[model samples]
Target: MRVIEAPSPNHEPRAAGVPLDTVVVHYTGMPTAAQAIDRLRDPAAKVSAHYLIETGGRVLRLVPEGRRAWHAGVACWQGLSDINSRSIGIELVNRGHAWGYHPFPESQLESLRVLLADILARYGIPPARVLGHSDVAPERKTDPGELFPWRTLAAHGLAVWPDPVQPPAETPPVAWFQARLAAVGYCTPQSGRLDDATAAVLAAFQRRFRPKAVTAAPDTGTAARLMGLTASA
Candidate 1:
């Protein structure tokens, strides 16, 4: 593979004794791939991903897979912390929501699949480990949003996809929904009330796993999907 040069200075050696087994995917969320690349390379920005896949499928390696890139900040997964040291980060190029967000190109996704397959095979990353920026940091971020083709990646065995069954028409109780979401590893509070934070987390979960319907409210369909995902995981 033709490797690109490092584009960011905000990285360091992986935390000692931390086993690397996760891969976090993200979108540049900038106006253009070039601009995103520049920002990642800027030391003052204090942020960088291991790889940046451009719209036409060009893959740029900003940081070595073995090092800790500053991609996932203040994140958590599966009760584990320090996600930066435990995951490989891939930043897909896209003008994100703030700058006229658009669908990721087919070529870019194909490249992502190929890269993810290779990474998974080499690192032995579990299906649940293949996640999004929002999955680890739901409160502060939403890049690689609902439009991301996670189902396509799942079809290629890169990630997990919840069942397509929609829940019954009558809305399930809030407690039932919160419990299911919490079971799925989301940072959902135990409170039965569906507050804004809960909605954000639910929306983030839907954006990653159940893209077809991502309403903030815990409808029957979202609840059912969350239950299926947790069970399968």
Candidate 2:
């Protein structure tokens, strides 16, 4: 991991006393890396991340890991808010959902594995705490999109992967899904119904662990995966 320092003036001091224990992955989502880099560096944009990985595997350092980069806005995870205060944000350069989302290149994934391992060593970020931008703010964002290689990350010991499980004949109720999602570290909706927010959370989970089915509507397979991951956690 040779990192190029490409500083951005869009960060602020992290909160007074917050332990940086989480890693949030995102996709640049612009037409090109240069445009995304410009947006991140522009102070008026009020957004930046600790680093950005280009498609060809070049790593650019935008903000110091010690400061808050204002990457996550209106996001939550496991009942915690103000995520930017306690997380390291890494933007993977890809044209996300809006611009014809595509699979991440092998070069990019290779560099991400190295970068994540280095950051996790310093902060001891847990596998379950390695999450996507969509994981924290499913209702507002989807980056490092469904096409991202989460299983590859898990194979490298950078994140967690659920073991295969047989789903019960009947799909679990929405309330059950909500409970299990919460247990698996998501900020689930407590409404006891299949609301959009809850569905978004479920989709995020599937994107991470069950990319085969991302319906957002709970199914037997989704339920089984959720149960397995929740139990493992």
Candidate 3:
């Protein structure tokens, strides 16, 4: 793999032999890739990803894959609190939801697929481990939002996808839905009430796994999909 290092001074060594098992994908949310790169390389910014993929499909290495990049701040996954120590972070260039969020370009996605395939193969990261930033910090972040094409990634064996009809219309009640969300590693409460936090979690989940229609309410299709995904996982 040919690479050029644009080293950032914002990262450090992983907490001694922490096995890498996750891949956190994100968007720069800036107006341009150059600005994103500048921010990432700025020590004062205190943020950096191992790699950044520009809109034109250019991949820039900001930190060595073996080192822990300071990207996933205060995040968790499947009981693991120190996510940066166990994952490689990739920042894709996009305006993000805050600005004029748009679909990722074709060239960029193709490049992303190639990079992700290599990473998944070399590290043996599971399909379930390929996740979005929002999945790790649903309460505060939502980069690589609903516009990201997760289904395309899954089709190439880079991630997992829920059944097209798992949570049939005749499925059980809200408790069942809540349980499935929890099972899939979402920080959803089991209260059976679809409150704001619950809705945000559900939306984040959909944005990563579903990506077609991210509604707040747990409808028949959404419930079925969540149940199917949990069972598969």
Per lDDT, the best of the predicted structures is 2
- Candidate 3 structure quality by residue, lDDT tens digits, 127-208: 8889899988877899889888888888998887887664575756667777777788776778887777778787888777
10 residues in a row with least lDDT, candidate 3:
165-174
Error of 3 at 207 (Å): 1.9
Every candidate's CA RMSD: 1.6, 1.0, 1.7
Q: Record all residue pairs in model 1 with backbone atoms less than 3 Å apart, i.e. clashing.
A: 7-41
Q: Each prediction's TM-score against the native?
A: 0.93, 0.97, 0.93
- Model 2 lDDT at residue 198: 91
lDDT of 2 by residue, 60-90 (tens): 9999999999788888988999899999999
Ranking by TM-score: 2, 1, 3
lDDT of 1 by residue, 1-233 (tens): 55577657778999899999999999999888889999999988999999999989889999988889999899877667799999999999999989998899999998898899899999898777898989888888997898998888888888888876656778888888777776777777779998887888888988876777778787777766776787655
Off by over 4 Å in 1: none
Worst 10 residues of 2 by lDDT: 224-233
* Local error of candidate 2 at residue 97 (angstroms): 1.2
